[model samples]
Target: MSDPYGPPPSDPQEPQGTPYGNQPYGQQPSGQQPYGTQPYNQQPYGQQPPGQPPYQQPYGGSGPSNPDERTWGGAAHWSALIGAFVALAFLGPLLVMLVKGNQSAYVRAQAVESLNFQLSILIYGIVSFVLAFVLIGFLLLPIVGLIWLVFTIIGSVKASNGELYRYPLTIRMVS
Candidate 1:
């Protein structure tokens, strides 16, 4: 059978070349400089290369992460309330801290703060529950719950707004 590609070019000295834009080595048509020979002072077209770390970029990255990252951190702070109502106040924040803590400092800080607060509330709740057997226990349990709810809401708001939030009553058990 005949080759569908019509055999190859037969000219021994005609110089093989790409049908695409490339014009082969040492034979660039008229004006263009060869690759990598850009003028010494010319900067690349977009995005400066990574080296010496720009004095201006903060947070040890090319630049601060986008706002969406901050939102995720904030959400982590708020999610602790879900655990609170479910009787596992540390689950949400603990999971977030374990899963995403290393990704961004802001997220890690929020997660840690939430976890600490939840743990403190857990301790307080246990104490209040045991004390409920006594005359004063009933009042303290409800008050603790109210305080937890209010503080969690405040922390969530501050985090969502990209502000640092430290739980006022947190005891730093997890640090």
Candidate 2:
């Protein structure tokens, strides 16, 4: 009786000596290199081939090359609406700027514009709140709010259309 746990007996009709039957497990059949070794002319990992240029990220300073980039630029302007409800309107444009700013100059510029506008609005709102005690703020506050809404909507539309829109009353604090 054969041992149950041992290797199975070789077949009589099969020609086998090495572990791979025709060649040893670690050896290549002929002039080929070993499994993990690279040939003499092969490039190292992550490097460009002989005549090819290295990979580079696209720069969009002149203009966005694709619709997705335009969308991101537009988002930088419209995101202010989300933060406005919480009285932290700068947070939305600031967030978009930090996340996508490095990848595209168009997005960075739009975010900066939105951030400046929000900051200007904040300052106006604060002054209006203080003036409310004198009864003047009660009127100025609503006007400021209305201006903010209209300008933000216009900026968003312009950005979505692939044009840069500068808010008329925005202080250029952010650049």
> Candidate 1 — what's its lDDT?
0.76
The lDDT of each candidate is: 0.76, 0.83
The collision pairs in model 1 are: none
TM per candidate comes to: 0.61, 0.64
Off by over 4 Å in 1: 1-64
- Candidate 1 lDDT over 34-136, as tens digits, reads 6766576676665466674543321333222668657766777778877757878788888888887777767777788888888899899999989989967
RMSD of 1: 15.5
Candidate 2 global TM-score: 0.64
Residue 96's lDDT in candidate 2:
85
**Candidates in order: C-alpha RMSD to true structure:** 15.5, 14.8
Please count the clashing residue pairs in each candidate, in the order shown: 0, 0
